[model samples]
Target: MKKTKTRLAAIAAVALSAVLACGVLAGCASDKGEQKASEQPEQTAAASLEGKSLNIYCGAGMTKPFQEIADAFKAQTGCEMNITFANAAQIQTQINTTQEGDFFIAGSADELKPVSDYVATSTDLVKHIPVLVVPADNPKGIQTVSDLVKCDTLLLGDPESTPIGKIAVKAMTDAGVMEQVKQSGSITTSTTAPQIAEALAKGEGDAAIVWKENAGKDGLTILENSGMEGYVKTVPSAELTCAADADAVKAFSEFLQSETAKNIWTKFGYELV
Candidate 1:
């Protein structure tokens, strides 16, 4: 009976020990699983991009393209993003005045560079070209750059303060057509590229002069550019102010330079400079 009691006690002790060991193992496994799950998303984001703040100048027609990049970055980084679009020129003025947002994208390099210069990342974000836009029906039978200068033809463009207008005027002048339009009393003015297209759609003008990227679109035809002699360029840039995540901005900026971005620019009838 004593031996039996001793044997029974030994068996009980072994069972309790086994149970305790299982509990400890399970606890460790649970902790490891939680830790692994927590690290997975972070690792994925690091490999791709993080969500971040991306403010673009109002005139940035490439919003759709950029938006795609922002979305990707967000998924990769698990961060948040707030995007605000406004006139590139006005946006620049705002950035210069108040120093707002994480990045600034403009219709022209002038606007992008100014803000970028403040951040020392100017050249990394620029695409230059003469802005070209026209009516949807190819009104004035615009086949060449010279046709845009028809004496009786009306041309709508952004105000001189806007990059689209600035480049349009430069290209037309380089093509020896802008002065002719002025001589013919055909130049009209709007505040933005979309406005110029709107005017043309309304039959307010014989043709429209806007950013080259605005050309060949539904509202307009792409007549011509100033080229080497008369071509103007639109440059775009990015900023680094309060960047939500460095990778997000970097990936997005690179997206602007990607083939997809180039395709968008070309489809819009813009000359890639």
Candidate 2:
């Protein structure tokens, strides 16, 4: 009876070891299969692009719709999109200095001038107008473009590197208040419209000139006055002449001109151009 019991225990141990070995082998196979599956998208994307990738330098404000459009493009074509959003002027500067990038989306056509040599062509997509945004209480009594000269702390986009800033500077210059505002030591500068909006919301400045779409932020008020007229800036997407694959860039540009992309821009409150 003792010998019989010992033999039965030894057989049970062997059976358990075999089961554990099978489980380990199955797990290894499962992991390898998953890794291959995860690599499929990238493999497919590379094939779709014919091994070429697109690089985009986009304006900060256009990020929302551009992202939506990029995702749609990726899903349809399996091509990869590398997008970087920043001040449009800054983007142009980088593109010019590096002589790289496949496309440039500027806040305005004026911003694209710096990279004209690298841009084969471009299309105007939307319009964004400048507006004076103030705290809800209307502090400093700022009611018009003329009032900007009176604010103790007035914020605007960096005119040298921002499209809105250029427009704001031009408008203030036209109003003959640019010199006064600058001399008054009241002018503050930001890189983008969203930054200007944030400064207004934080009460960091008495007022800021920002895009109309950004005027609706809480704790801020859009000063509606005719003085803000003629400040319209248009958004344009340029196809770069330096692109490694012109066909791919052209296809993406065509997508931007589609009704689908137009709807995406409209959904973000941009006026279709």
Candidate 3:
């Protein structure tokens, strides 16, 4: 009887040891599984986008900032970006004709209207405010919107082909000064906001109405309280229907609103939406 009891006790001890070993092994495995799960998302994101490519239609005014954002995106995901920079209206026309872009980044939501059917998703990214820009030092003493009439030459974006141009007309009309502006000075129109800024830099006009961000360029100064506070436009980035890889497009669209992209935009003087 004593021998049998001793043998049973030994058997119980072995069984307990086996159970404890399994528990420890299971604990280790569980820890390893959790660690792997924690690491999976980032790895999966990079893997999914690696070697993918996207075609982007970006506004000409946003070129500098968007290029930086694109560089960051490519570095993170290993994706290639093929960007086409033009005025928002011109980009809209291109989208309608080609139907071959992955995304469209416009200066205003209005520019997206013509290509609405081709858009799968749209996200407002920044604010595009119109401001009166003049040569540094206020050479013409142009201090107000109404004062635009006193200028010898005025530069404006083409109302038919640029978002800034459309906003310029509407804002002035809302202020009841559009007719006066048109009648007083020789108005020169450009197809893009950058062109207007360039013209101003080259001393092509005494005053020019361009996007607020462009007013930061060298040799330009924004006129404070120029009465354009009410006419701000929202910049939008849209995913197009032509995106061959929806996953890749979605990833990039998300990146456009990421903190990194926001920093880039702000660095270029754009206001966050």
State the displacement of the C-alpha of residue 149, model 3, in Å, after optimal TM-score superposition. Answer: 0.4
Q: Per-residue CA lDDT of candidate 1, range 99-211, in tens?
A: 65666656656666556645636443334444444566654666655676652555554644577676667666767877777777777777666667666766677766665
Question: For residue 101, what is the lDDT in candidate 1?
Answer: 63
Q: Give the TM-score of candidate 2.
A: 0.78
Task: Please identify which of the two predictions, 1 or 3, would achieve the higher lDDT against the true structure.
Answer: 3
Q: Is candidate 1 or candidate 3 better by TM-score?
A: 3
* Candidate 1 lDDT score at position 77: 53
**Model 3 collision count:** 0
By TM-score, who's the top model here?
Answer: 3
Candidate 3, superposed: residue stretches over 4 Å from native? 1-37
Could you tell me the TM-score of candidate 1? 0.64
Candidate 3: the clashing residue pairs are: none
Candidates 1 and 2 compared by TM-score, better number? 2
Error of 3 at 106 (Å): 0.8
Candidates sorted on lDDT, descending: 3, 2, 1
Q: Give the lDDT of residue 148 in candidate 3.
A: 75
Question: What tens-digit string does per-residue lDDT give for candidate 2 at 1-273?
Answer: 999999999999999999999999999999999999999986765457555568999888667778998888876776788999999766877887889899888888888777889988888888877888889998688888888877999888998888888888888888889899999998889998888888889889998888887766889988887388788878888888888887688678877988988888888778887
Q: Please list the residue runs of candidate 2 whose C-alpha ends up more than 4 Å from where it truly belongs after superposition.
A: 1-52
lDDT of 1 at 252: 62
